[model samples]
Target: MLSTFILSQTKFDDVNELVKAGEFTKASKLIDEKVKTMNLLHEEIFQLQFEKERLERIRKDFNKTADDILKYARKYYPNATESDLRKWEDDGSLEYKIIDGKKWYFARAASNLFRINKEAKKQKELIDGFKKDPLDVFLESYTPKVLDESANAQEKLVKPVTFRLNYTVTVEPNAVPNGEVIRCWLPFPREGHERQQNIKLLGINSDEYVIASNDNLQRTIYFEKVAQKDQPTVFNIVLEVTNYSEVNFIEPTQIKPYNKNSGLYKTFTSERAPHIVFTDKIKNLSKEIVGEEKNPYLIAKKIFTWISTNIPWAGAREYSTIENISEYCLTRKHGDCGIKTLLFMTLCRYNGIPAKWQSGWMLHPGEVNLHDWCEIYLEGYGWVPVDQSFGMVDSEKEDEKYFFLGSIDPYHLIINDDYSTPIFPAKIFPRSETVDFQRGELEWRGGNLYFDKWDYHMEVEYIEPK
Candidate 1:
């Protein structure tokens, strides 16, 4: 039947004769079947055509140039191997780019790969229990302890603390078009239980000018160009806070840790945390540890351990704001030198230990920078300096990593006192004051807060610790 069907379907004369002799109708039926087969093939061709267009669109969307991919990969991986990058491309994990005759991978893809690597390392450390190096361990383990409030009860008994204030002003030549005569007013500390009233002009040099004031009023040393200059010239002015009386030891003024309530105090305290961390450790270790047998030296050792174990030293995002330290502790779980010191101070204050603030910028022949630590009042020993941020002693025994609390390096320039005092003579424009001592002003040329504004800066030096 199949042979007869084939013959009838053929278009040759012999085949036609066969079909006519046997069954032309069967041959016609076979021809109809072949036509149906052709129609089915046409449908397949249409489906393939649609698929081709769809694939083309997908290729366009996924396509990336070599240069683009390479640039992104370099930025993201920074140290990734070329082979690995190629494998990533093969795996369809990254896109490529070509720009300026260069090849690159997508930055996002590279970053993803790098993240995976870091996470792996972190996990390995977590699992291995390989003791982190002293420094690494110290950075991870430091926390500021709470101070004992009872110890500071004597703060009220001590004489009002006093400090000498000193400053130098630089007058620029040609600062004004003409030789302008300038009058300067110096800021005095503010009013409270303390009194700062006496004023004195020590001396003046091309770069050296000095003024002295009694009483704790926040004052601004004003300079008026009495004579205008054609060329910019510089002059130095100095002022001294020769008298800081300690009427009594004040308790932690704010409820927050390390007196975090005041914005200015918070900034100064946090800015100086690293140094405080070390000092706090020493203070803690030197204590009796509550239940342990009392050994002053042993206690000091424990304090050092506690400091190294608790506070993690890291740079702060912004040290200028008052709440910088507290906020940092809350989020990053770490802080710079200043904040650590404040934490230590707070802890000591809470535990009946007397701790106070101390800070200054390090000044070399050509550079000056800010630094802070603390001081504790000890019986008979008086106030001794403590720089916990520098770390513990016998530093060589534990490596540089463990040397942050209890001591300080020599590269510091001390500037301000432990507590914030207002600028003296009351700024021509009244300004808000803070414990960490930041001074800002708003003025009205007239008798109102809405006067035209002016600004000033004060730089202090410790010629000799009084």
Candidate 2:
């Protein structure tokens, strides 16, 4: 069960069983029956109510039918056949579920199939004419330059790019009563990092808004607005930040053994249940991959290389619905940026390497979107950026091939230093995004508003170096 489940009673255990077995209808019925009979605590009642919402979210993610998948796949593969679809499903390349005697593919399955399957991507490129991910193309040109600059300058951070962004969130009309107050928490740039600095708030839409302190692990800019009849509620913030590409040229000879008594090492290496647990599977895989490696940096490199080569990136479902994100990614054999990053962090922690989450947005030109990566601590080197999703690049040079293992590019907008941390002013309801906080959160006195109730957009203007 997901850590979100608040109740520990025996009946709640039964509900958990039903949910695990995909008996959502039965689970909902059981919840209703228990609610009518049991003297549940307020938190218990809230958890029970949310179980239904969780089921609804699952349905939304797994709503596409077999026919729909076929129609979508044919857009790329005109000769796509049912046999090919079944092969993909069997191999876990195309995720689907058997729901009530019918097949329901993941909403993003069609597009993800091309991403995870090499042959599918080849076919699509043949039809669409040699396509490449813009971000990868961008990296190919700048990675060598950033490494060279860092080496020559004798500095970790180099190649700074300042950006001006107008981030906006709009709630659909009549999402709540016209007179009701809506609370929103927009993603704010995290302060006090070597690579991400000079954060400036240029302007904001709301006259009265609370900007959380720099120390809030998952930071935000909170606002409250009264809904208007037949009009959408909107919140906006304009900010400027200078991001730098970090290239830590790690020398294995200078690396020191970790002090076991240190708090930072202990806290980050220890298990955090539900997400970063050191399960049997995780421990076994760590041993298989990390064999006799004693150097912390070397151990981390092995983990990063294994994951990048094994787990192909794919679109993921909402984080709130997942029980264990790392385990889920490991089981599915594919995941998005956040999913791969979690698995990487978990493996590093299991090997006694301190790893922590870092995410906000990727400010790549014409390709801005929410993204995730992590940081790992070395005794002598301190914490360095590691982007498992970016992984190993195709280059003969050591610096460029393992760029993300100990370094990162300049396009990051880090909004959260740690995962699953509380927002400032305290949210009355559970956050829509339990893990990462990039999209922004909204709620009313009535209840928390899920992603479907509103939309968010970011417009980035690169502040060219003067």
Number of the top lDDT candidate: 2
lDDT of 2 by residue, 1-466 (tens): 2322322223368888877777778888888898889999876777787777777777888999778888989988778889989999888789877654557888999999988888898888888898667778888888999988988899878989999999999999999998999999999998898888889999998789899999998899999899999999999999999999888899877899999788998999988867888888898999999999999999999999999999988899988778788888888988889999999999999989999999999988878899999999998999998999889887888789899998998898999999888888788777788788899989999988999999999999998687
lDDT of each residue in 1-466, candidate 1, tens digit only: 1100001023335424433343433444444555556554643333333222222222333244554445555544455566766776554444443422345333344433322244423544555555645633433332111011212443312211223334443334433336444434433332221222223445344343323243433333433433355443333344343322122112222112323364443443332332233344434433434335333222333444555455555433223223234333423334556666665565454343456776654332233334566665433333444565555543344423332333222323333354444444333322222333322222223211110122334454434334
What are the root-mean-square deviations of the candidates from the true structure over C-alphas? 28.3, 2.2
Off by over 4 Å in 2: 1-11, 76-83
What lDDT does the true structure give each of the candidates? 0.38, 0.87
TM-scores for every candidate against the unseen true structure? 0.38, 0.95
Candidate 1 ranges beyond 4 A from true positions: 1-235, 238-320, 324-331, 364-367, 397-413, 428-466
TM-score of 1: 0.38
Q: Pick out the ten consecutive residues of candidate 2 with the lowest summed lDDT.
A: 1-10
